[model samples]
Every structure is written in C-alpha cells, then in structure tokens.
Target chain A: MDMGKGVGLVETKYITVASHPHELTLESGQHFGPVEVAYETYGELNQRGDNCIIVPHALTGEAHVAGRHTPEDRVAGWWDELIGPGRALDTNKYFVVAANVIGGCCGTTGPKSTNPETGKPYGADFPLITIRDMVQVQYLLLKNLGIRRIKAVIGGSMGGMQVLEWALMYPEMVEAIVPIAASGRLAAQCIAFNAVQREAITGDSDFKGGHYYPGPGPIRGMGLARQIATITYKSDESWASKFGRTFSSIRPQDYYSLDNRFEVEHYLDYQGEKLVQRFDANTYLYLTKAMDLHDLGRGRGEYREVFSRFRGKVLSIGVSSDFLYPKYYQEEIHHFFKQAGADSHYWELISPYGHDAFLIEFKKMSLKIAQFMQTLS
Target chain B: MDMGKGVGLVETKYITVASHPHELTLESGQHFGPVEVAYETYGELNQRGDNCIIVPHALTGEAHVAGRHTPEDRVAGWWDELIGPGRALDTNKYFVVAANVIGGCCGTTGPKSTNPETGKPYGADFPLITIRDMVQVQYLLLKNLGIRRIKAVIGGSMGGMQVLEWALMYPEMVEAIVPIAASGRLAAQCIAFNAVQREAITGDSDFKGGHYYPGPGPIRGMGLARQIATITYKSDESWASKFGRTFSSIRPQDYYSLDNRFEVEHYLDYQGEKLVQRFDANTYLYLTKAMDLHDLGRGRGEYREVFSRFRGKVLSIGVSSDFLYPKYYQEEIHHFFKQAGADSHYWELISPYGHDAFLIEFKKMSLKIAQFMQTLS
Candidate 1:
C-alpha cells in the first residue's frame, strides 16, 4: 500500500490492540475483537511529546492522510494539500498522526478483516462501534507510540466527531481541539440520508443480507449510495456553477434515450464508480451507522454539560454551505464551549462545496489552523 | 377507481386524443400516441363559457381533483381541500377541471399504456414528453369538452410547469395563471436529484430494462427513488420537529442491527412502500425526465420574451422553505412577468413543509387564490 512518490515522506504503520486474551468491548456491549489499526505519522516527537497532533480520518478516508507511498500511485493522501512541510498542518513544526477508524476498511481491522475465532470476514457479524470506540483505539495507538499529551486533535466531518470525543474523554491530554463540519449529534435529516444510503446497499439483491463478499459484491447498490452521497457533499450553488444546465457533450441520438444528459449526471456517475473501486460496501454501512449513533450527550446530560468537561482551547470551524452538518451545529459547539467558561473560537469557511468544503478549501483552512495554533501556547 | 364516501360530486372521465389515424408529436421531435387524458370537473360551465379553470396534475398526481367515486374509497383527490365550494378554486363560482398529465400512469396514456404499434405496454419505449407536450394534450382535452376559453390555468410542482406552458403556448385562451412551487426551468440541483432517482430505477436488475411490467416490477428501485424524493419534499425543520432524534419505538437487540432506528427512517420507508403500491416505475422515470426538460425559454427567446405573449394576470406562489423549488425560482418568474408588462402578484407561503407546503397548506393557498381570482375578471 505505497502511497506514491514526491508527495510526502510519511509511511503507514500498524499496531495491534485487544489481541490474545484481551477483547475490545463495543458500545453495543458486544465484545469480539483482536483489533489492528493502520496509522501514519509525520515529523519527529519532541522531548515532551506535546507537539503531537492527532488527526482522525473521516467516514471514507484512510490512514494515508498525506504523501504518496509509491511513485506509481496516482492519487495522493486525502489531505495532502494541507499536511506537508510548510503546509497548513506543517509537518516540519508538528508531529502529526492519523489512523483508520475501527470500522474503516483502509488497512484497519473492519468488516473486511478476518475474525480470529471463525477464520472468516466479520461481514454483518462485526460488532457495532461508535465514535468513542474509535477514539479509544486511537488512544491505544498513541500510547503505543509513547505519546501522552496532544498539541491538538483536529478533523472534519466523521473525523471531527472523533475529535470531539477525544477532547471530551481526555480533556487534560489534549491542549486544543478543532472540529470542522461536524455536530454534537447527527441531525434528523442527516440520519434520513444515511438511512436511505444503507437501504440502497442492503436492498440490493446481490447484498444477500451483507454476505455478498467473496463475490461481485453489491457494486450497483454501493455505486448508487455513493451517487446519493456525492450530492449532499456539494451545494446547489457549487453544482450550478460547476455543471449548470449544460448538456453532456456526448448526446444521445434519440431525445428519449436514458443516456447521461447533463454534465452533472456524468460527474456523479464518475464519483460513484471511483468510490466503488477503492471502498468496501459493508464498511460504508458500519461507519455511517456509527456516525448516526454519534451523540455526545447520549447517556450524559445536556450538550453544554457534556462539553463543559473539555478544558482545551476549542477552535470550531464550519462550512457556510454545509447542509449535512450546517453552520448552526458548529455554532452550538462554540456556544457551549464559551458558556462553559472555556477559551473557544469559531471561524466559518465561506465555500459552496457544502460539507466537502473542509476538504477542498485547504488553503483557507490551513491559514486558519496556523493562526489558531499560534495562539495555543 | 372508486373514491369513496364523504367526498365531493366530481367524477373522473377520459377522452382519447391523437388515437389511430393521428399520432401526437412531442417536443423532442418524436411522435407516439393515441393518448388518453383522464379528467374530473367540478361545478357547471357558465352561459359565457369563460368561467372554466383548468387545473393540471403534478407528477404522481391523478385526474381525481375532488370527491370519491364510491363509498369504500379511502383516499380523496389530491387537491380536494383547495378546490371544493368556498375553497381556492371555488367550485361554487368556477368550473374547475383537473386532468392527469400525458406521461402519467393515472388512467393516462403513459409508459403503462398499450403501444398501438406493438400492441404491448410502452414501458421504457414511451417517447419522451415535455411540459409543453403535456399542455398540448390537455389543450386537446379542453377543446374536446367544447371549452374554447380558460378563465385560468393553475397548478403546483410539475403541474405548475404545465401552467406556465399553457399561458405561453395558448396565451389568448387563458385569462389568468397561477404557478406554485415551480420554476420556469429546472435548476442544476433539481436535475441532479432527478438523475440519481432515474439511476436508482434503471440500475435495479429487476427493472429488466423497464420491461418489468406483467411482473413484480422494479419495486425496490422505485421504493428507493421515493425515499430519496420524500426527503426533498419536506424541509429539514419540518423533519426535525416531526421526528427529531427520537429512535423508533422498536429498538434492535444489537446496536449494530440495520433496523429503522429513527422515526424519520420509518416514515420515509412507509412513504416509499406506499408509492410502490400505486405507481409504475417506468412512469416515474418518464415524468421526472419530462420535468428535467421543463425550460420555458427553450427554443423561445428569453424568459421575458416568451412571457410577453401572455396577456393574462400572473399570480406566482412560493414556499418559504422549499429547497427543491426555492422561493428564488418563483421570484424569477414574477420578475420576468413584470418585466414583460403582465399584471402579476407574488405571494410567499410561510411554511415548514418545504415544497410540500403547496399541497399541505391549503387554507393559506385558498385565501391567496380567492383574493387573486377576485382581480382576474
């Protein structure tokens, strides 16, 4: 899994946890894991190890947060734009770490991973894991790397969910927390979208009740799910600006033909097909379900009460056009942080990319992160 | 199709047009028909014959504008609340007529109708029709009924598109026009949603190239499409207020189970299943495609130029929270209508039901329509 050349100098590494007699207990009270996590690191750990920044990957992201492992790899890391030397993350000044979450398929122990007991892929039998469970695994990974205090835990979308959990669960261990394009809990509309996506996968005849592995898999269903998701990742303004009413150059001879008519249709199809090539369908279901279960005050009290536990300097960022985790969600986090007497700040990235602005608008994000980090003593 | 008791006196009737010796030509330059339009009328034609108001059905709508055909019928006409005596259309004072659109499956010539050439169901082979084509068919139906002049043409959603077309295509015949929750042209985001829905239906293996009729049909795909559509029909605020984060009463034994955990999920599923029971998948595809092609200015110069031909009063209504056909779309229509020197009025319905407000907020709509009608004569 070489990420390619001339990208970054970081290489992915793995650590095994809950192995042997130790099993990982999930939020569902189900315990069945000898889990392994694939991670990547940049820069060098300092004497105090306080400069270590924990970067968690989003739902479809991987441990390869920056750089290319091999020259032949066409695509660089997901956050390659902001994670290199002198970049927003500035690997030169900070020790950065990113890992694939518990239910992710990118070199992590997930549904694609084989169960030691049954010697078979977990598939639908995989235990349900939550955002907190993912953070716990990353905690173990950080401990294994001999790191204790974190300079900051920053991420966007699902990754931001983990950042929130880490800051809340280990307030003293983290000095600063930045959660971008994320909310304290999944909104009803967000949950509805996720539900339809899951239905798309599960309803596929090829899914065979999530046992479609070792075959063609639910490619069509997964593609359709991706198609649905890609729409939400972008805003109406972005789509209109990028691929308006312009018909596709490849027009069908018959006006009634079901060929891709609009350029936007072709773009969505391309995105869906691209994701199907690199991602696992079952893991998509698992991760999205984990997201739907992400409520900071589930068993806790009010949101402000839960956020009060974090003493870190909070820098919450929101995307103006992000309908998935609208700006109001970020504002709530900032409001609660300030109400709790914590040092908090909020910045909105004005972009039409919607929830995906966090990924696309790297230059602006990097500038904001750099400025925020400078004030974090 | 008996519409049961406790309903108004309207009874559905059908008229065949472009049948046998005559074939209907579509906007796409393709021809195929022997089209039948199912219509229902309320009230009587006045001596002047100028009190006839044409009401066009939206996508998935029918000819039953009010009343029940039988005592056992459970579902009344879609616009029953707004078309009865003292209501919006005011059957007491106006002769209101509603007809199933040309590409509809509700007793109309559509994908489910028999293709005279093949003597089989048209299915996917149904020629693509547009808003203007649907207006043309309705025009023939109106002419057959011996109604040479229309007091007004009013509708919402796709129906609204037809209303716009009717005012433009038969300007001299229509005295007033009302288009609700609709635009002169489909936006990129709207087109994108339609494209994904079509993909959902066409991708279903069970679809068998839209030849699933006489079989189980593409029930799963159609259901998924409906699920996706139901989300756009309502606002996020509406869903949050109605369903919130409340989990379904039936909790899964395991947190990981793919059960419908949220009330919104269950609600969407119910809607999907409900639509599957009555609608044909191929017709959904055809109608959506037709909507995507609804550009009033197409082949006609600018919007103002096309609208200038109508010497009628225009009352354009918009829902405050409609994301699919936002208020801006309605504003555009009003802007152009005024620019073209037509007498026009714009009303915004304050509602949380999103695009569905036009269908659900009947009382507000009725008041507005009543006021607008007073100025029409």
Candidate 2:
C-alpha cells in the first residue's frame, strides 16, 4: 500500500502502426496511417502475458507513467505515485504500459510529427482524432508487443475516456477498466470551454492558420487558454484556500494599476506560461477535439447496452468537486454498466481538488483503486 | 404579479459625482472624479419618500432596469420581468431606481468616457473602484434626485454584491436589501475567472495597453473573454439541457477541420462576438477588477461584525445550482447576518440557471421579492 517510486529509470520505447498509407480507417471514415506510439513500461511480462495493465495518459500528459528517464530529469512520471512496486498498479505483480496518444505532441506522432509522405511536420494537416482512434493506436502497439491480453486498463480524466474505449474496443483483452474523473460524453459547458481555448489559440495573429511553427506562436493565447482551463481543474474551495483575494507580492503598492495581480491571477498566468513551453497549441486543439468527441455510445447504441455487452468489470471513480466532469458523470458510467448487467463499481473521491483530485489525492486514489482490483482477484 | 412591462418606456437619466479632485476618495485612496451615472427610474416618489428601491447593475449591465428605451427597442430592460406596475419592484407601490455601476461601459461614464482633466478617454487611467465606491456613486445620484429613505435595494450577481455593500455603507437609509445569487465577497474561483477574462482582453495584441479605442479594438480578445464569462454564468444542467453535444449546422461534413464548431461552441462564439459589438475591453477589465476587490469585510471587520452594525434587514437569495458564486455563498451571507443577530431571510431560488438564475428565473424571483417586501409593509 505504501510502495513509492519503485519503478525506476524507465525508458520510453516507440512502435509504429498503420505503416505506409495508414490502412487504419478512422471513425470519420478517413484513412490515416503510419502512426508512431511512444510508450514506457514498468515491471515484467509473465509467460502468460495476462498480467498487464495499460496506463493511458490524460490530455497534456506523456507516456511517462512512473520513474525518471534520467537521474536529473527533475521529477518522476506524472503517475509515479500510483504505479510501481506494491503500488496501486503494483508493477511487481503486473506489467504496466503507458502511452502518448495518437494526437499527442510528446514523442508520439501528431500534429507536430513529420508526415512521411510530405516529409514535413504534419502541422495543420493532422487529422481530427477521436478517443477511439487513440485507443486503436494503443491496440496496434499492444498487438505488436505481444500484449495479447491486458489485466486491466486504468486512467483518469481523458485517460478514463480511453479506458472506457479500451473495454469497448477489445472487451476480451481488457479484463477490467478503471476510469476516474471522466464522462461518457463531454458536457456542453466543457465543449464551450474547449471552444474558447481553441479560439484563444487560433485568435492569435501569429497562429497563421495553425502553421505557426518555428516560433513560440500564440503563447499569449495558449496562456489564456491554460488560465481558463486551470480554473476548471481546481475547485472553489481549492482556490479560496490557496488564494482567497490575496494580492500578489509583485508591486504590492500598485493596487490602482490594471496590471495588479491577485495571487490566483499570478498562479493562472504562471501555469499558462509554464504549459506553453512544453506543449503545442496545435496538439491542444486536436486533443480537446478528441475529448469533446469522446462518446461511449457514439455510433454504438445506448451506453447501457454497450457497457452491458462488455465482459470486463468497471470501476468508475469521480472526485466530488470535479465540476469539469461532475461526480454524477461517473455515476452515470457506473449506472450504464449495472443497467447493462456488466460488473460495475462506483466510488467517489471526496476532495476539493476538482478534476485534479485524481493526480493530487494519490493516497485516496490508490487505496480505492487497490480495493477495486481486489474484487476481481 | 404579471405586470407585463407596465413600466412602459423609460428614459435613462445621468448625474455626476466627485467633481474636481474627486472629493470622493476610493477604497484604494485614489480620487476619481466626474463620474456620470446612467440610471432609469420606475414609479413616482411617494409622499413618504420611504417607498424607494435602488437597483445596482451587475458587470456589463446598464442602468435601464425595467423598460424599453425606445418603443422600437427589441426588448425591455434587462430585469424588466421583475420591475413594473404590478411586478416585484412594482411602480404602483414603490419607486425603483437602477444605475449602471461606475466601471460599466453602458451610458455611464467609464473607461470610454472623456476625462475632463485631459479631454481624453480615461482608457486605462480609470481608478480602481470597489463595491463601496459604486455605492457612494449611487448615494450621490440619489442625493441629486432629492431621494431620501429607501424601501430596499435589490440586485442579483454583481448587483447583489452592491446590495450587500449598500446595507453596510448607508445602514439607516436602506431598510431592507435583497442580494440574489451573490457572494458577500467574491469566491477565489470567481476572481480567477475574472483574472482570465482580463488576461484575454489584455492579452490581445491590439489592446495596446488599454488605449485601443475607435478601431473596434481587441474584438477577438473581448470575444474570448465573453466566451469564458458566458460559460461560468450558466450551470451544467442548463448547458446540457440547452445544447448537449449537438453539432452546429455549419458545414457538418467538415468535422475534421479545426474550424468546425459544436452547437455549444457556436453558441459561445456567437455570444462572445455579439457582446464585443457593445462592450469595451477596458470596461470589462475595470468592472471585473471592481468585482474582484468586492469584499464585504475589507476595511470593515468580519462580515458578522459588519452586519451586526447595520440596522437594515437582509433577504439573501441563492440559486440552487449557481457554481460561479455557489449557493453556499448565499448561505454564508445569511449565516453572517444570523451570527450578527440581524433581521435576515435566506431564500433559495430553485434554478438550474446557475449564477444567471437571478436573471432567467423571473417568476420565482418576483414572487420571492414580493413576499420579502410584504414583511416590511
């Protein structure tokens, strides 16, 4: 229960799918191929290769699920707290694969990836991707790695959406799915948030129709988008406790200037600026689209029917203060599983961190995740 | 109760305050002079002069509270639903005066107003005003109108904040005050939302340090700011009901394009674009600053002590699902009144309209306001 940083110095590995003409037909009926998936694995694959958990990254996350790439890499993986020896995923007992999704801009192929045919970065030519397409790329990567069956697929936020898709796309292969802080469909307000974020990015004169590469294009817009998004990721309680109208130390005497920063404003500006450096505006646009388009029942029948058809057990967890994906959404996902007669469990993480509780409340999340996995064993 | 615009056509009137050297000192110790307040009045002043209610407008709202400016105007005032001959503010019973806040971009003198000191628009030179300063401006306008005692002050959102401030500033003149879907002080999240909005406006390259006037300046930035503000204004239930995952009718086949719009996104864009035509970015920045600095217990002691000192009766109202201000905010306001042993009533308007419920739920708000008024009579 207290395993910490046991998965050490894990290196990212890459594999290609839909090579040459991308024989992969997208959900949009379009053919896109030659996708490179960047992934990292922890623990060993047993002879049966059945004890493997796939850790899907959330939006803006990379394939580093645990451990540091180098001793000086600053910090461990994004989910380093929950996926290691004796941890929630318990790398000691199960192999774990974490991947950068198809439309991501990390080491994976995406809008910033070079197009094989044109021999240039895809840039604006990147196809609109769906959660299912992302799941499909992972499937191909798994197939190539001889990961014929996954013990469980676990993730939070957009990662949770991928977990849901994994259960639907490869039911027999995924024995269980733990989707945390996710929704069957994006909420209208969420879509609106995404719209404004996109607008902020593209509204920048330097955007140049999303071809603003080779420069820090639309940094201000991306910063604004991040600031907006950062607001949704944290709750009212979190902000009140952390900031609460406290003026910033930056020129404390200048309250009359429009440039005066509230502590919260400073936090938002800092976050926005920090994110733009490691992230791309084009990828942000593409990933949000995938998220907005994420629907468990899209093209498929009702979520109840689709979930009922899946043989895997489901653990849909929600953070109580997650306004982005409200707690009710996780209940709806669990309800769909139960109504469809599939094995289901619903758990709410009582935290004020909002959508970010999944990443912040590691102890609570691990405890619940571990308990849910025990039911299957 | 169904007055049905009985107030009829009303003309907006203006009054000046803080003439030279800004005889009025702001909470920031800065002197802001020659503030022209735009206001509209309903009903005639009764012989008792005690039957009057001062209405304070929310951010971006003008003083025209309950009637059409022109017979040809498409719609009546913003809160026309609750103020008329037989409405909540009932012109037949009580005189109601509504004024645009000092930082507002309405007919009121604001950032867009010509500064008599230099014969140029204040632009960014507008002093940082607080809810208290706004109340002072209203007091001046009322004094100019030869109005004395007031029956009540009622407003929602930022209006509600002013109502709270009115009770504190002029405890004796204001008898009863109703603050709906408002906070005693803005929540940190609300401040954060305001921060990003200000960021969006100022982030615009054309903002040019807040002097981008006469050229339709920062249209995109203002649009983005509005889009963000619009999202926070409504509740999740309202958005899902109004525009759940619906695609826009604009070129449905081109979902792959980054330019593709979801119905909700289109709605946000439309709202953002529509607002820019009337509102100025500098005003948005200034007004949001005022709201951010709105703390009921700033220079005063705790809210409990402040309310304890005020002799006014308070009817604090909250919408059930107002996430921006949150219903707990109203509860907090009511709790302060109770803890201070003051005459107070807390009424929750059952609404999924969120912070906007005060504006959208007219019938319920009217009925509650009428019921609250009867106690004083």
Candidate 3:
C-alpha cells in the first residue's frame, strides 16, 4: 500500500483509498464504525520515507489546505502561502500531507455522513469523540498508507492540539512537532466560551436538540455564536483599526429602520454566514467539547509525566495577542519539554490578529515553522 | 407661581405626579398632546432664590435620583452622594431637583403612560422627542417652581446632555453647569450600541412593536439588550477585576441541566433580570432614539455657533475609560466652548468603571462639581 505521490500541484491519484471499514470507539463508550478518512498529498516520499509532514486542521477546516492544480478544484487552498513552492514548508522540498479529521463535515465520516445501519445521515447519533480518538483514527489512516512515521507534524490552535496528541501517542513515529497558539489544557474561560456557543445553538427555538438537521438547527444562534467567537479570535486593536465606529457609505432608502450599515457589523455578518454555510452545527459542538476535554496530562497525572511520554523534539509557537491561549501557555509546555530533556524550541510570533494569528500572519509563522523543520533535517 | 421654601432638606418634597401631561407644538410641524414629566425635589428654596441646583438623571434613571424618605420608597437614589447634608451639593446648602424625562417609565409621561384620549398606554404612539424637548420640559418645571434662575445645574451622561441643553436654551437661568461623562452629540459608536439594543428587543417574537402592553413585550429580548448594554457600561478590565472566571464553590446540584453555574454567567443573568423588572420595553426604544438624535447643533448648524449660545459657566467632566463617550468627545465640546469664548472648564476623571464611572465615582465627581460651583459663587 505504497500510496505516495511525487511533488507537484497535488492533482495525482494519491487520494483514492480502497473502500474499508475503520472503527473509532469514542470517549462516551459508544462506537463509531466504518469511518472514511479523506486526505491529499504533495511532494515526493524519500527512499527512506523520512521527509513527511502531517498537517492537521482545526474545527471546520477541510483537507483542502493547499493547491489549485485541477480546473475543477481551481480554488486556492486554505493555507496556500505556507504550503506552496518556495514558501515556508516548501512543497518542492518536503512531502506534505493533510487529511480531513474524522467526525468532520469535510468529506470525512461525521454526523452528516450516511450510517450503514440506517441509510440516513448519522445526525445526533454519532458517538462523541475526543482529540485522542481523532488522533487514533489519523494514525490508522497513516498506517493504511504504508507510512510508518512522520518527519514532523505542524498545526496551530486545535491543529496544534492534534500535533501534541500525535507526539504523545506515537512517540517514535513523530520526529518533531510544532504546536502553535495552543495550550496544554483548555482554560476555564475557553470552556466557558464553548459552553456559551453550545447554549446559543441549543437555545434557539428551531434547534430541537441535534435533531433539527433535516431543517435548520439554530442557524441564527449558530451565527450569533460565530459572531461572538470572531470577536475573541481577533484583537481589540484590529477591530478599532479596521471598523472603529465607521458605517458603510451604502444606505438603504429607509434608513430609519434598524439595520447594520457599519463595516464591522457587515464583517461579522459575513464571517458568521460563511461559517454557518461551511460548518456543521453538531461537529462544532463535538469538536469544541474535544478541545475542552484536551489536557495532555489528564490521566497521566502531571504535565512533566505527559511530556515525558513524547520522545519527539518539540517546536512550539505562541502569538503575542492570543488571549484565548496566551504565550504563557506555550512557555509552560516549553518548560515541560525542557524539563523532560526533549530537544525542544519555543518561539512567540508577535501578531495583532490574536488567536487567529497563525492563519492571518502566515508569512511570519511560516518562516519560523520552516526554519525549525530545516534544523530538524 | 413662586413655589419656594426655606433652604433645608425638610422643606423639600418628593413630588410624584404619576403621569403629569402638558400639550406642546413641535418645530417639526407636529402637534403632540399632553406630554407628562415625572419629577422630585430636595432642600429648600430661599426668597432671593439664588440657591437652586438642578440634578439631571442619566439614561434609564428616573426622578428618584436622590434619597426617598418613605420606607416603601426608601431605595437610595442613584446619586445619593451629592444630595445629603454637608455633602458636595449639600441639601442644606442648595435646593436640588431631579426629573424623569418625557419618555421614561417611572412616574413620567412615557410609552407606558396612559393616553388621555384613549385610556391606553401611549406605547409607540408617543411622538419622538429631542434632548432639546426634554430641556424645554425641565425649563417649564423650573418656571413652575417660581425659580427665575438656577445657581448650578449638574448631571452625567444623558444628564450631561440635558445640562448642555439647559446652558444653551436658558443661559441666564443657569449660572453654572457641570456636564459629566457626556458629549454634545452621541458618537457613531454610541448610536451603533443603541441600535443593537433596540434590535435585541424588536428581534424577539413577543415584541408586538410597543403594543405588547396587553401582555408583555419580550422580557428575554429586553434582558439580552440589558446584558449587552451592561457590558459596554463597564470596561473589560472591570469585569476581569470583579469576576474574572469563578464558579460558585457549591454548585446548585439541582441545576445539572442547562442554566449556568459560573459567577460571570450568574452576574449577567442577574443584571438582565433586574433591568427587565423596572424598565418598559417601549420606553427603552423611545429614550434611546432620543439619545441617538441628541446633537446639540443638528439644526443650529456648526458646533461653535450652537455652543456660543451658552453664556453660562460650564464645568465639563469626562471619564478616562468611558468608551461609550470617550474623553475625546468632551475635548471636542471643550474646544467648541473655548472657540466660542464661553465661560467653560473641562475636567477628565480617571476611573476604571468606564461610562458607569459617573454613578460609581459620584463622590469624586460631586467634589469636582461642588468646588467648581463654589468658584462661581
């Protein structure tokens, strides 16, 4: 099963996997069976098969993290700048892989996918999964591809959570890991944000629990949640700079009625609407819960003990303005890595984008991740 | 018409006329009938009548801005600090007066007030009023008291707006004016906040467009609006300082379902519930609209020209952390006052309470106003 392809625009037949059933037992004791993992690949696998990178995404992100080679898929990838030729990760140099995480809306087995038991969408019956469970499924995906190990794993925020999980769960398999804008455990504030987001969805009259799938399950509530979350993701300074008290020049004939004509309000509406269109509501609930439950040292006791499990070199990055998971959190992980005697490096990316800094300030973040990987080489 | 008593608190009376109406013709080619103003008084008026101090209430404040003697009405006034004996605007020293604006819930002519024509609450039928109109009513109240002139007029936020109007509309009547945490005109952001608040109420299904008096007009929506407004009233710094992220020690074991357990969540719920209890939804709409339309120079043209009309001594105080109406707004007014060659002074109060700083830091503000008034004397 040497399902590997050479470096190019990633239009190769690398994504086709023989139809197979992969079971994922969740944290809630219920089992999710026959999962399909959709992935894409770039760059050549070396003869030794060592130069490989697994790019895990945050919630609602698709496997289309790069490229626009195919005419049908001409749309640019979510991370085109960081993953393309001569830039950061440099697809011309290293084999980069990105897979839609299990229990995702993006081509992966999720609530939206058909359940074999009943020919309908899994809907609310989908078993709740933890970050570790998602990682285990990813591990299985890699195993099926005849890939024994990864040279490095790079991701930020929830992506970073996956990287941490990968490093700890498969110590020998991961040579290096970069976790950006991530924390060892979700803070109470982070959990609170999630709780509110969940409540917004559940609070809506249209939302009959998770059963309002055939119709709309609290789209407005979900939009409101995203609007609130968007506020937290960006810095206050950014909002002040861009939209500070300025209304759009465009005016409706009846301006007396309550309507959002401000640039910031429009911006929030766009963000909220786009999110609602692309993201499944149930997946948001499940993934947020995963992030909340994620503490590398949960059963392992202390952080040192958790770090001790990871034999891989750690390269962690934090954003200066990311109040959600501040720089202190990355520093704590760095200290643990150092104490655990791992070849660890820590860096802080000074960006005003806050928690979304990794996504927005890609040029700076890419250089740092590339440099760290080059050092590993 | 000379309604005067000796200069003492005992001589002052808490005048409560539930729906005192007076008909008036508007400059907008509109004739509105029987508008009511709820009001209260403190201290005694001298025969010479040069000791009156009109204390305007802030947004959402009623005529009960000072102490209520009766046990049933014993709730301390919003600004009790400035009204007591030997205090800043000492009741023993000055005759104090406060009034519920035309479009208010408490004993004033508002949406909730009965329409003399139909015996139903005015509700949405209450014609729109400008801050100038509010000032006009206050002027009548003053004349009705047989007070030819006020020694000083002091107020904060919306009250400050009224104070500015008083100085402009009746320059000779006002000897000195203290406008705190306010601007000549509501800023774009301020208007935007008000718009959101109005939307929260109107967006609710239960809101029958101010005609919900038959039942109730969306208590949940009103609550949500209050929650949002409360956030703006205080700075994020204040919330972090007061209740960062703390859950009660003993969880309400019975509340295992949805309703929040976190202190911050509870705090928000309490604030929302408290506001809905006292406030009329329709009144909230009308008053906020008036606040939005409150530009002192809207029809009067340029800033300086409108401000030049004020010959009274102005003592303007702005809060450092009030993002709602920032210090820059006060500076704008101060610049106009300076440019107009008006007798004016501006003070910036440094407080972490933000817009609500005026109410919470009343003692400090009272001292500043008292000292300024004494200088005029």
lDDT of each: 0.85, 0.85, 0.73
Residues B76-163, candidate 2, lDDT per residue (tens digit)? Answer: 8889888887777778888899888887888777888888888888888888877888898899888887789999999988899999
Two-chain DockQ for each candidate model: 0.64, 0.80, 0.14
Estimate the lDDT of model 2.
0.85
**For candidate 2 chain A, which ten residues in a row score worst on lDDT?**
A249-258
Better of 1 and 2 by DockQ: 2
Residue range A147-227, candidate 1, lDDT tens digits: 978999999999999999998888889999999999988888888899889888887888887777778788888988998
Q: Please write out the lDDT profile of model 3 over residues A244-325, one tens digit for every residue.
A: 5565646543223323255666777688788998888877877776776677976677666789887678988988877667
Task: Give the interface RMSD values of the models in order.
Answer: 1.4, 1.2, 5.0
What ranking of all candidate models by lDDT puts the best one first? 2, 1, 3
Distance from true location, Cα of B217 in model 3, Å: 2.4
Please, what are the lDDT tens digits per residue for candidate 3 over residues B230-286? 766776456556775455537543222223355656676688789899999987887
Deviation from native of the Cα of residue A262 in model 2, angstroms: 1.3
Ranked by TM-score, the better of candidates 1 and 3 is 1
TM-score of 1: 0.95
lDDT of 3 at A13: 27
TM-score of each: 0.95, 0.98, 0.75
